[model samples]
Target chain A: MNSFQLLNGLTFAALLFVVASGFTLVFGLLRIVNLSHGALYLLGGYIGYSTATMTGSFGLGMLAAMLGVAAVGLVLDQGLLRFVRGQELRQVLLSLGVALVLNDVALVIWGGDSFTVPTPELLFGAVPVLDTFYPKYRLFVLGMGVLVFVLLWLLLNHTRLGALIRAGVDDPEMVEASGVNIRRVFVLTFLLGCALAGLGGVMGGAFLALYPSADAEILVFSLAVVVIGGRGSLVGAAIGAVMVGLLNTMGQVWFPELAYFVIFGPMAALLAFRPLGLLGRAV
Target chain B: MLQVEDIQAYYGEAHIVQGASLTVNAGEVVALLGRNGMGKTTLIRAIMGMAPPQLRSGRVRWQGQDLVGLKPHEIAARRIAIVPQGRRLFPSLTVVEHLTMVKSARATEGWTVERVFGLFPRLAERKGHRGNQLSGGERQMLAIGRALMLDPELILMDEPSEGLAPAMVQRVEEIVLDLKRTGLAILMVEQNLYSALTTADRIYVLETGRMVMETTGAAANADEAPLRRHLGI
Candidate 1:
């Protein structure tokens, strides 16, 4: 592929990584599929658009979106999800219901029109990349992805909370028996994951305009990323995101008619070969 | 101190721990001995507020606090810890991470990572190893060390010698004796009568979920016939 296609792939993968990282972590820790993740993304985008418009600050818009979605996630978990915590099928159905409700909410609030978050003046221009110039905002998104990956890596590797999350993933009962409030851990992780979803929404909004059904579309891509990467694995998500993102870009460029098949056909083959995913362990 | 009175636990429809009562005083080592499938592990799980032998009726009073309705973490915060059956180590986490993950309940100085290392030097050697990578003996040491890191006043250990070699079981006995010297109360469940006889100050024999016999470990060690008869071994 050409440099432009490559950059498109990398930047797109970066967005997928941000969205799917939280997706994987939540699944790893909570065992909740969180079908509303796409809804969260769309909601975050619209919230960002409004906030940025009202306050006239891109940064503030991003902040509002994250916090708002986090609050919503908290309510969803404590109010609804907790009732069916260990019932996997029920949680999935509940989240699907929530997602549908959220999609309607977005349509009611933001309507069916597509709108991009107005690019900040600072990031409006393009800069030199490997072989050509690229949009500075996309590059900024790339930087954000790298920063998030690094921060999450450090958090998981060097911090106590990270250890608890990893341990909880393995054996939550033992972690609790060791005297750590695993519920609090769950809440914190949920918030972090949701906030990232919000962040991804805003970032994706600015990169590609927000509209109806966007939630489902993003959700599908993220699901593909997680399934291919391995449920609940950070490095796996990163690799899967890149693979999906590049394939997506290549498909759109070369054979727009077969883009959907291009993205999912390989996933089907991979799943048939490795049902646990590339890096997933048996839960 | 821990007091368990009339704790009736069940697994679905199966009544596992039927009206079991026992106690472990502060600075004491108490072992519950039973044959396989006799509800020893279930009783421990009930005390820790774990599910799948849901506590139907029970009172596990630890440090004067009734443990009913408390989540497992809350019980842990009440200065209690558990070395669960099969080690139950986080397969992906390193040994040091396991020790460090515990948020000690007590404000005062207690078990630190360094002290745990000092107590189990082999754990120190395997500090960087993940839970799955450790040998059986090392996993047991790490499990015990992980419990101690909680700075708990009491520990509930389930099947500490279940899968260990005899040499490792001997090592576990030494560690239990060492822990007893630290004045930390322990409630241990074991099928290994010899290990229990060596380390426990007090022994309770469970027969089909009931406490059939209670005697000092010294007495039991002196006269294994009574304990063995109750255990049917």
Candidate 2:
């Protein structure tokens, strides 16, 4: 309704897009629901928190989170999920178990208390916007989101790897039969998706504190974004994130009692009309 | 050169390709002809190590090396490519993207994107069109062009003329002949009996997952009776 709410919606949507884009990609190419994505978020947040605290460099924390979380994702995919590659139900259950286990692991490491990444000194103030001032950090987050979108667009459009990913999304078997090492592509995609989730985790942790249940909350929001957007579409994920982010922020302000309903209502309506989602193809 | 020695592939428990065997010598176009559900496609997929029907027994050899346990891409890396049934073009990829997606790490002397474009001029004209947007004939051309991008020593084509017009079928035959002149081996599975007879140097008839007959294309074309009896056509 107001500028602050709009900014809040857009910034939150930016973070949601970062997380859900990765989620949707993994679903798109690797065909995994990857429920542990939230746990990866929480773990990355905790790792980033520690790194920032120890080294006093927010940049290091971001780098550490992305690399660390991607390593975990590599282990998850190559070690556990590879055995049950085509079994969707098994992957779901396995990733769910991993999520629960990682959630507890974070609990043991960071305890039940909430933690936040301190805003860097360079971004420690507010900037003036239309009719009001907004945190420079949030604006930076929005810029990062735009940068990611642009970079991904370029990668998918201009680069050979991007073409492979897009083609793999359409028909992976056909891509492989054309002499591409599709398994290598799958691993690269999973790593990139996990790394993005980690980056989103650090960014989200800075703005919204990270705690035990935060992982579940972020995971649910990401799942909503992916479902509304379509399983494997990048543009769909961005649009879906913005829609959900705006609705969520506006609903909490206008009608707190009906906030969840306000979000799910439109999503349910969209699903009833477009069962394959806005850009999804038949799986 | 490729050889399939007594491969038994199954879809879960349903045995689809039961003890089928065939071979394609270098520079030869071998056709596997059969009725619907006679496991022609299954044999092709089995050779490629695709699942369901899963390969339970036998060996697929390329250049004298066994390929039974290799991944589909690994098998493809051995200079073999598949133009699958239905074209299986990436519905989202444009014509040029399809050709470029095949990374040219192997023999650089073979087909390039430019060469493929030259080969299929229709594909060159509609270079920006997505796979789903192409006409059936154009889709077939693009599929063949995509396979050629790998510069494959051998190609596995499944029903290359399944739904083409008569003129398009003639175009496909010309392409097969053209590739053969370049010394490329091809293992084609086809439901269209006449199409196979035209492009194939040798033909094998499959009956209920078994190789019931093997004859030269010339012999089969000369006496269509035994081929017709085996094919039940």
Candidate 3:
């Protein structure tokens, strides 16, 4: 309700958009419920933290996070998921195995104590927004969200790769039969999606801090956002993120006891009217 | 050139394509004709490496390279494209997007998006429309256009005239012949005898997953009785 709360909501939404888009796109194209996504997010933040600590550059850390997670995604897709093909159940279980393994690996590498990724010196301070001051890092996240939106728009609408992604989402075999190496497309999309999660994780870590339980929390938030947004739509993910982000922050502010109730209440109503979610096409 | 020699495929325990074999030379238009449930589509799927009936034994050779074990995209990369039965189009993609999404097998002198639009002006007019939004005829045209985008040397069209109006059937016939004129080889599966008679250089009949008959276009055209005996139409 208040400006401060509204700003917090928007900032939260921006990060959510970055994370949930990857989740939905991977699911849409491959029908793989990549449980490893949250682990990847956590991995990104931890790697980003270590990379920045070593390099003394937030940019390099971000880059390393994205590339590192992308590498992991490619390995998962090419080495294991490709062999499974069309068994959604097998894929889900495989991904769960990956998630648990990665979670353990992360725990071994980084301790259970929480750590916050430092905002770049350029975005270290606060900026005035309406009456109260807002963190510059939040504004930076908002800017990154806008950039991601535009980039995704151009990629999906104007690029051949985008067309392939959309087509693959509809019928992957048909795309392959069109003489396209849809295998490469699938792998690349998976990597790109994971990279997005990495970016979001680093950004989110700046605000939310990196801790043992953060991955589970983000995974839950991302799942809720994708379910509300509907799968197979970039615009839907963005809108869903904003709705969930606002509801989460507002619920805590107004009705602390029933925050879960506040979030699910609207989601349930929306699903009752449109079972396919906001923008999801039928499977 | 393509050759399917002694290929046997199965759907679990149910034998589908039993010793099916056929060949297509360059600039040839071959029609695969059979009654419904004769495994005409299963043969096509086998050739394309899509397994419903897994290829248990076969040598699918294209230009001396065995394609039995190659993936769908690899087969496609060898300049083979399938306009699959029911048009299997991506319902979400726009007409223009369909033509742009493919990776052309031919680097140069290939079918471009503009060329496809010129071939089917109706598709050009509705370039912005999604695949599901287009009419039956338009959907068929878009499917063909999508295949053309790959610039394949050989195109496999499965029941291209299926579910089409009489007028649309005529259009598809003309389009098939027009594509043939470009010196591209075509293997078309058609129930429409007229379209087959019109476009095919040779016709092969499949009876329950086996190649039952093969006849030249000229001989088949001259004597309808022999072809009619196979088709029963």
Candidate 4:
């Protein structure tokens, strides 16, 4: 309806891209729908909040949250997920339990408090754009999202690890047969995805405010992002995030009562028709 | 050098590989001949530990070390690799990326990426092409080149000539012989009987997942009767 609303939509989309990319990457490589990703995201937010409060440095909080959650991802992958392997039902149940346990434990530690991470003083004010003022912190969120996109592109395309990831993504058995330690690849990819989700949590926590049920809330956004984007394509995630993010903001602006209804409509339609999303090969 | 003895593998309840045995000595090429659905592919899967046809009982030994129950990567690290059925090229990856994605696990000098390029100049010419962009012959060349990149002591080639043209099949046969000259052992499963007869040092026939006949390549090449009898070509 307005310029500010459109900017709000774009910023929201940027954050969604950062959050859902990890979920998509995990699905792409491991063929697992990690239900605990949302818990990990929430845990990162709390960790980022606590660490920033103690150190008075927001950057340190971001780093600690990423590393901390990545370690949990490794443990989850090695300790439990590895055992289940292709049993999709078992994987879902195990990850769901982990999510519930982590969220409950987080409630105990953080005590359901709602707070937002303080953007640095340099990014603490508003900037005028298109005859309107937008939060500088929101702009930073958009910038961080773009920065992540560029970094992921370089990592997936320009590096040796990226080649292995892509090759494994295409034909994992062949990669293993070609003499790669595929387990190492799996672990590394899991860690990368975890770190990304954690980074997204830090940003999301700052923007949306850290609070209880934030995990569940973001989980809904993430699942919708990936499903509408197609299961695991990075470009698909980016487009889907933008699509969902804009759709959410627009729905809230024009149709308040039917916001969520509109938000998930595209995903349902895609599943009924083109289940692979855009840019995805057939199942 | 490799020895696969009495390997009984299964795909769930279906007994796909029922007690098959074969061997490939050092610097030798052993052609495994069988009709379609005779468990030739499953035997290769069992050897590589892909495990759809789970190796229920088998003794696959290489240089006196047991290969049974080893993971695919472990088997590969011990200097064995597979070309795989259908080429199995990573469609999104470029030809050069396909070869460079894998490195030799053993601390030995075998085949390097450049060496592979020298062996298959066609691949070198199309090194920048994506796997899916390559022609069937090119896919086979890239697949073999990828297997060579692991610097394997023994390579398992499954249907490298399955869909190739006659000229390409001849090229593949020459490549196998060339690999043997460089002291790399090969176990090639081929439907093209002529390619196998020309390239292999020894030949073994499998029927219904069982090894039924064994003979030298020279003998098989000299006489079409055994080839005609076993394969009914």
Candidate 5:
């Protein structure tokens, strides 16, 4: 791939990392497949677009989108996920139902037309990179993705709270017996994961047009990222997203006829060799 | 000090521990001895507030406060730690991480990671090894070290010596004695009568979910017939 394509691939991978990281965290800690995560991402983009349009402030729109989706995540965890804990099938079914309802709700509110949040004026311009013009907003998204990764790594490895979370990821029962309030950890994880998805929605919406069915489309890609990265592994998710992002981007560039098959073929092959994905450990 | 007053615990509708009561004083080591399925674990579960052994009716008081409805984490925060049966270590975590995770609850000036390493030098050597990679004895040491990291005022050890080799059992006994010298109270449940009597200051014999006899370790060990009959040894 050319330097421009490589940079673009990296930028796309960064967004995928942010979105998939949360999915991995929830899956790793709670062992719950939160299907509504896609809906949260879609809702966040719509919220960001409307908020930015109303307030004429992109930053505020992103903030409002994050907080709103985080609140929604809290409600999902406390009001819905709590009741369906320990039953994987039930959680999937319930979350899928919620996702469908959320999609319809968004459609009713935002209508059928696609919407876009114009990139911030400062970041709207393009920067010269290796003789190719790269959108400044995409670079900003890449920077934010790296910042979030480092922050999350520090939070999970350095702090006492992070220790508790890591311990929960390893053995939740042991965490509970250690006198750490595991329920609070669960709620915090849920909110944090959803917040990341919301951020992804906003950034992604800015990059790609947002419509009512955007949730389903993003969900498929995010799920593919999670599967290739392995369940519950943040580093794995990041690595997997970069690999998949490169493959998907390069496939379209080099072999457009077999691009879709090329993207999923590696996932199928990886699963065949390691059912837990590239970095997943057997639970 | 701890007092379990007529605690009736059940697994669903099946009552496992019916009115079982016992006590452990500060710096003392007590043993809850019984045959399999005779409610020894049920009593421990009741005290720890673990599910299945629902505290149907009873009061578990430690330091003069009721522990009947407290969650397991609350019970641990209140200075009670349990080395559950089978040494339930986090299979993915290393020994060092296990100790570090629960270090928040460690008693000030007591049972630091250094101290735990001192107690179980084997764990120190295998600090980076995951739980599943360790032998049974090593896993047991890691479990003990994990509990010690909490710096609990009172520890409930369920079958710590179970399934360990004789050498490991001796090492565990020495550690128990050392913990007792440091003024940590312990309630141990054991199938190994000889090892239990060696470490425990007092013994509570259970039969079919009821406390049949309570005696000092010396007295119980002196009367081998009663010990053997109750334990089915």
Candidate 6:
């Protein structure tokens, strides 16, 4: 692939990583699918769009979106998933119901019209990366993605709280027996994951235009990224996103008819060979 | 340091521990002797606040505080640790990681990782091995080490020597005696009457979830009739 294409692919992969990382985190720790994660992302974008329109500041919009979706996530955790523990089918149905409700809610507020946040003037221009120019906003998204990845890595690996999280992931009963409140950990993890999704939604809206149906399409891609990356590993999610992103962009470029198969084909093969995605521990 | 006063525990509607009363003084090793199905493990579970064994009535007071409504972690945070039946080690974690994960929030001069390793050198040798990789003896040692990491005031050991070799059982006995010397209270539930009598300061014979007999160490060793009758030894 050309350098321009490569940079574009990397930028796309970075966005995917941002969204899928949270999906995987919630799935890994809580064993919750959180099908409404896409709705949360879409809600974040709408909140950001409205806030930015009102205040004329993208940064403030992002902050508002983060806080708004974090509250939504906490509500989902406490009101919904906490009561429906271990019932995967029920969670799926309920989350799908949440997605429908959120879509209707967005339609009532933002309507069916497409919308976009004007890229900040500071990040409006393109920067020459290799042989061609790359969007500065895309570069910012990539940079932010890496920064969050690093921060999350440090948080999950270096801190005492991180040790408890890891312990919970490995065996939650043992974690509870170890004198850490596993419920608090669950709530905190859910909020953190949702906040990431919300941030991704806002940034992604800028990258790709936002519409009501955007949640459904993005949810599919996010699920694909998570499955390909393995369920619980953050590093796996990032790597899987890059691999899928490259295949996605390149498949459309190189093989249009075979594009859809590219993502699932490799995943199926990987599962057949390793079962656990690359960098994922066996459950 | 621990008092279980006529505590009635149940699994669903089936009463498991029917008004079982027992006590373990500070620095004492008390054995709750019973057969496999006689609610020994159930009573321990009720005391630990684990589910399935619902505390129907009576009280489990530790240093005069009621333990009925507390969660398992809250109970553990109060300095009560359990080397549970089946040595419930996290199978993915190494012995060292298992111990390190549960390191006490409140530091105590009595027990440290170093001291635990010193007590069970076999555990130190197998520190890097995952829970599933270790033999039964090694797993039991790791379980004890994991509990000791909490620096617990009272440890409930359920079948510590359940599936160990004779030598490993002897080593475990030594560890228990050493722990008693350091003034930590222990409540052990064991079917091995001889081993229980050898280490325990006092013994409570449980028959069908009720305490049938209580005796001192000397009396327990001297008399095997109760054990022979109840446990069919």
- Which is the leading candidate under lDDT? 1
Off by over 4 Å in 5: A1-4, A128-132, A250-260, B5-15, B36-38, B91-96, B105-141, B163-165, B207-213
Residues A40-132, candidate 3: write the lDDT tens digits: 899899888889878888899899999999998888888888888889999989988988888888889998888888767999889899999
Candidate 4: list runs displaced more than 4 Å: B104-109
True contacts kept of 4: 0.87
Q: What would the per-residue lDDT of candidate 1 be over residues A120-151, giving only the tens digit for each residue?
A: 89999999988899999999999988999999
Question: Best to worst by DockQ, what's the order?
Answer: 2, 1, 4, 3, 5, 6
Name the 10 consecutive residues with the lowest summed lDDT in model 4 chain A.
A274-283
For each candidate in turn, the TM-score is 0.97, 0.97, 0.94, 0.97, 0.89, 0.88
Those runs of model 1 whose alpha carbons end farther than 4 Å from true positions after fitting are: B104-108
DockQ for candidate 5, please give it: 0.59
Candidate 3 structure quality by residue, lDDT tens digits, B69-150: 8889899888889999999878777887787777432334678877888899999899899888989999999898888877
Q: Candidate 1, overall lDDT?
A: 0.90
Docking class of 1: medium
What is the TM-score (0 to 1) of candidate 1? 0.97
Per-residue lDDT of candidate 1, residues B1-233 (tens digit)? 78999999989999988999999999999999989899999999888888777888979888788998888888887878999998899988888888878843233477788888899888888889999999999999999988888778888999899889999999999998888888888999998888998899999988898999999989998899999898888
| Candidate 6 lDDT, A197-277, residue by residue in tens | 888888888888799889987787788888878887888889888988888878777888998787778878888877767
lDDT of 5 by residue, A1-283 (tens): 8978988888888888888888889988888888888999999999888998898888888898889999999888888888988899999999999999888999999998988876779998889988799989989989988988999988876677776777788778768888878999988988999999888888888988789888887777778888998888888888888887798789889999998777799889989998988888776
True C-alpha contacts between chains kept, each model in order: 0.94, 0.87, 0.87, 0.87, 0.65, 0.46
Model 4 lDDT per residue over A167-282, tens place: 88898888888788888988898898888888888888888998888888888998899888877688889999999999999899999999998888867887788767776775
Of all true interface contacts, what fraction is found in model 2? 0.87
DockQ for candidate 3, please give it: 0.71
**Residue pairs in steric clash, candidate 6?**
none
lDDT of 2 at A178: 84
Tell me the tens digit of each residue's lDDT in model 5 across B1-233: 79999988878889888898999999999998999999998898788877767887889999999988888899998989989899988875677878877875344576788888887788889988878899999998888888877779998999999999999899888988888999899999998888887998899899888998888988877887887877778
- Model 2, range A92-197, lDDT digits (tens) per residue? 9999999999999899988999889987999988999998899999999998888888888888788888889999888888888888888899999999999988
- Candidate 3 overall Cα lDDT vs. reference? 0.88
Interface RMSD of 4: 1.5
